[model samples]
Target: MTQALTLARPYARAAFALSREGGRTAAWSQALAFASRVAADPQAQALLGHPLLNPADAVGLLAPDGADEAFTRFLGLLADNRRLVLLPEITGQFEELRAEAERVVKAKVTAASELPSAELDAIKAALKKRFGREVEIETAVDASLIGGAVIDAGDVVIDGSLKGKLERLQSTLSQ
Candidate 1:
């Protein structure tokens, strides 16, 4: 995982720079995401590794017709280098750069049960206030949490779940 990230860093930075210069961060984000998804597909993965496939054909497999010339060129470069498998990591890094530029943060919240819309909104509002940036929340239900929620917001993790509390209590009692 670390190696893939290391390999992806330069490409991601280059793509981010291009997007920033062109004032098309959102567009590049979508294109990278789409390409990543395509590259992850089993059939597409096989095609990407096919010895007979040319770089142009590989780019066409991932990119839509009439894509921006810059994006096509980027895809072609990846294809030429046989780095199509790094698309997902590149997309992730690109999103991180985009979020930093836009003053936004992505957070994951896992709860024992589905949170009410109002509750979720309140959580998001609080996160935005705490982080001093727009927070985009992704929620998941984890029955193992037993109760409450655990929030993973960038470098900050708030383990508020019942399971987490129990574990902490156990450790304290042991000590």
Candidate 2:
């Protein structure tokens, strides 16, 4: 992971610089998503390990149609260097770039079950009201929670799940 990040940092920085200048940060996200799909393909993975696949051929294979030319050239560099496997790192870096530019934080919330639309909206509204910035949410289900939800956003975690309460009760009883 460290090596991948190290390898990806330069490419990500270059892409970020170019996209920011054009005010096309979302383009970086889309391009990185496309690159991620290309990197994850079985044939692409195999090709990454092949000694015979030159950079230009690899770039031709990985570059999807409709991609921005600048982004394509950026991806070409990675392909040429056989560093496509570090795509996840590049995505993470690009996300950071977008976040820094937008001043919005992305958050993930895991609950025992699916949250209703109303509840999710309320949460987002409350977060926005408190934080004074747009909050981007990603949610998932974790059945082990039994009930309630655990919200993690940036440095804050609000653990309101039944499982957490139960553990706290157990500790109190034992004490």
Candidate 3:
């Protein structure tokens, strides 16, 4: 994993520079997502792992079709260098660049059940007030939580779930 990430870093930095220059950061994000999905296919995985498939053939298999020339070229370069397996890391770096430029933070919320719009609105309002930034929230349902919700954004995690509270109480009593 470390080796893959190290190999992916330079390519990601180059792509980030191009996207920034072309004012197509969002486009790059979409392109990276599509490329990553394509590269994640079982056939692609097999081809990537096989020592018999040379760099050129690997690139041909990975490159995107018409209408996405620049992105296709980027994928081709990665594949030709036997780096197609690093798509996940490349995607991560691209997202990091986009997030930094957009000043956007992604907040993930997991609740015992789905949150109502009103409750989500309240949470959003409080998060906005606390962080003083634009936040894009993604919510999920986790029945194991039992009740309440957990919010994780950047380095801060506000866990206010009944399951978490009970676990803490259990620990305390045990201690």
Q: Report the number of the highest-lDDT candidate.
A: 1
Q: How accurate locally is residue 1 in candidate 2, as Cα lDDT from 0 to 100?
A: 75
Q: For residues 1-175, what per-residue lDDT tens digits would candidate 1 score against the true structure?
A: 9999999999999999998888888889999999999999999899899989999989988996556889999999999999999999999999999999999989999999999999999999999999999999999999999999999999999999999999999999999
Residue-by-residue lDDT tens digits, candidate 3, 83-113: 8888988988778777877877779999999
Number of the top candidate by TM-score? Answer: 1
At residue 20, candidate 2 shows an lDDT of 86
User: Which residue ranges in model 2 land beyond 4 Å of their true spot?
Assistant: none
For candidate 1, the 10 contiguous residues with the lowest summed lDDT are 60-69
The predictions' CA RMSDs to the true structure, in order, are: 1.0, 1.8, 2.1
Instruction: Go through the candidates in order and give each one's C-alpha lDDT.
Output: 0.94, 0.83, 0.82
In angstroms, give how far residue 103 of model 1 lies from its true place.
Answer: 0.5
Ranking by TM-score: 1, 2, 3
Error (Å) of candidate 1 at residue 174 is: 1.7
lDDT for model 2, on a 0 to 1 scale?
Answer: 0.83
Q: What does candidate 2 score on TM?
A: 0.89
Model 1 lDDT, full chain set: 0.94
